[model samples]
Target: MTSNTILQNATETTISGDAQVINAGRDVNMVHGPPAGLSQLLRPVSNATYTRSGPVAKCDPGTRVEVINMIRNWLNRRDKQSVCWLNGPAGYGKSALSQTIAERYANKGRLLGSFFFLRGAGDRSHIARLIPTLAHQISISVPVTKRLIGRALEEDCTMLDSSASIVHQFQRLIANPLSSPLNLFSFFAKSKILVIDGLDECDDKVQMAEFIEMLIDMSQRDQLPCRIFLTSRVEEHIRKKFGDARAQSVLYCIDLAAFDARPDIQLYFEQEFGHIYDQNLPIMRRIPQPWPSSQALSVLLDKAGSSFMFAATLVRLVGEDSMPSKVLQEVLDSGSNGLDPLYKQVLSSASPTPAFHRVIGTIMILLTNQSIESLSLLLDIQAGEIVFELLKVQSIVKIPGDDNKPIMLYHTSLRDFLTTKS
Candidate 1:
């Protein structure tokens, strides 16, 4: 099927509030409930039905069509590589595209699993949870594997434990189950895929390297049943690992920076601005038909510099503020270039102080994620005060309703901005 057709179906499903798509050829529907013991350990992304906290970002339809079609074609091809690595710099929309692909395959009962590595999101940001999470999702989606995974867990209770080697987890919880006779016979999909987004975001560098090596090993040996789709910023270690001679045969790589994204950015800005204009029609009635003039859009597009995050952040800022025109002007007027000026604008609006710096700084440099309550105790500040400070920068910072949930930046660029030496 064409990418546009797939997107149209997905859009219809989303609009109906029913995430399920008609299982065209599958014997059984993808399981909803998590597999037994491993259920608690899985850290799946927030998509369609699976419930992980925090907001999920998806590619805006009509945008990213070329990349989407390329990935879809890769997934559907018969004699394709087992692993596809889509890498780009931050804010280039890697995660958004991953989310889009996952949702598309998931609706078709072909997605085995997906894990989006979110920094400051507890287990979601760690590699230790990755294999187990994929195992759990696989079991639930492929029923035959559920029993096999359970049996494996029963035999080696430590298979899912953090102390266990990643190789052990992959072998026992994932490879063994899916490759088993019963599973291979029962789970008869042409393509079963696992989407891993933001691998660079995972906190454990050692584990991340080990996991990539393990994937290469498995792919080389043809031991895994599902194709692996991964998206991440182009970190040195990851690039080096994937660049290994051994990986060349089975690994397909795409760099987002190579694409001319100006057209896509234009489409996104047009649609988003149109939405904003429609929503605030009464207030915006006086504005011209093309509310944001072509000249204004060209300026914003040039500033975007192949970064979707910049475009998206600009849209969020303008849409949320009462004075949309003013927000757009301020963003254009910022003297500095790239995401820094925008980041600075957002940070400055929060009215930074020693206390604010202490709060946000602690979040940025945290070795691991912490909840507001825990952060309060660690910093010796009241939880309410932390919330008050975060409120000013709600556009960039995400403050969860529950104090126990981790506070997170909408994008990692905020931390980069804060840490970069002036």
Candidate 2:
């Protein structure tokens, strides 16, 4: 199908919240899901829903359309050899954009599968979890392979057998099914895109680099029809790997920072506030107020420093507790250092006692980027005790999941602000 037609049909299908079913040819029919397993798999373990709610800010619709068009083109192209790298700093909405595109294609009966790598979530860090998650996402039965993989595990397994170094295993598992003539094109036809987000956040940078190389190899060989769309911070290791010869001609790299941000940021915040006001406080609804008042938004825009997380956090913090007037005053007075006001608000809400502060300070100093268990040892405190204390103030401290390892700040800005203070 043409890209435009695919987009239109996809949008229409989504309006009714039903999957588009297509009969390719003969008696062979491909039905997209009313209850797609892939959609359920993409959801974060904590939150099953796909939509993000926040204040509405201006988003460059033109840019968004361009991105969507590019991805749609890649998926529609018969060559099936391209890989798209969408790189951006934390909180730049790269994942959100990709997710939206995946959903649109899935609705249109174009997408085969997708995976979201959530940082600090247990499944995100380990290769064992990552591979199985992706396999499940594609609705490929994995019982036999899962049993083989499980049996390979040993308490004293060498590096080759360890769960952490499962790159070869993943490549084999994904590639073997498509190696056969009968299943090659059929398998590829079923999966139009392989969406992977937050490559930099994966704990083992080395393994992530290997996985990217393997993907590059697979794309070059044209062994599968799937195009990989990866979103990450442009970390050094990833840049080097993508710079390799295999990626030179086939890869399309788009930097998130290069895009104009003013519109999208404005749209995001505006939408968020509008939703809350309309749905929660119908009586208080009025003509949409121009948020950030140009002057205030300019300050927020400047202070955000190209980080959407910073901007969103500030908006949420100020809007939740204070009036518009107060929020504006706080932003203006704080000037370029608006982060402090947000941080302070979070801190105050945390209500950290002298002991809590000491514990936090110690963790901040001794294990600036280490996991929670490491912090527990440095503090000479039980891991559970530390976790309980941190969870009480999670909004400020950024506690990781129970199944996950350590907790940290939602952003580096929080860690920087906390550690630098006397």
Please provide TM-scores, in order, for all candidate models, with all chains considered together: 0.84, 0.65
How far off is residue 370 in model 2, in Å?
13
For model 2, give the RMSD to the true fold: 14.7
User: Where in model 1 is the C-alpha error above 4 Å?
Assistant: 1-51, 184-190, 281-283, 353-355, 376-385
Q: Give the TM-score of candidate 1.
A: 0.84
Query: Residue 337: error of model 2 in Å?
Result: 5.7
- lDDT: worst 10-residue window of model 1: 1-10
User: How do the residues 317-381 of candidate 2 rate in per-residue lDDT, one tens digit apiece?
Assistant: 54454354454456567645545666775666666766577667775665324566776676677
Residue pair clashes in candidate 1: none
lDDT per residue as tens, model 1, 1-422: 21112433233333243233324333323323333355654443432123454676788878889899888888887653888999998999998898888889889988888888877666777777777777778878888887788777667756666699988888887777777777654345437788888989888888898889888988888776677898888788888899899999888888899999999999999999999999988778888879689987888889998999888888887887777877888887776557778877877777887778899889888866678999899999999999988887777877889998778788987887877788
lDDT of each: 0.79, 0.58
lDDT of 1 at 315: 84
lDDT comparing candidate 2 with the true structure? 0.58
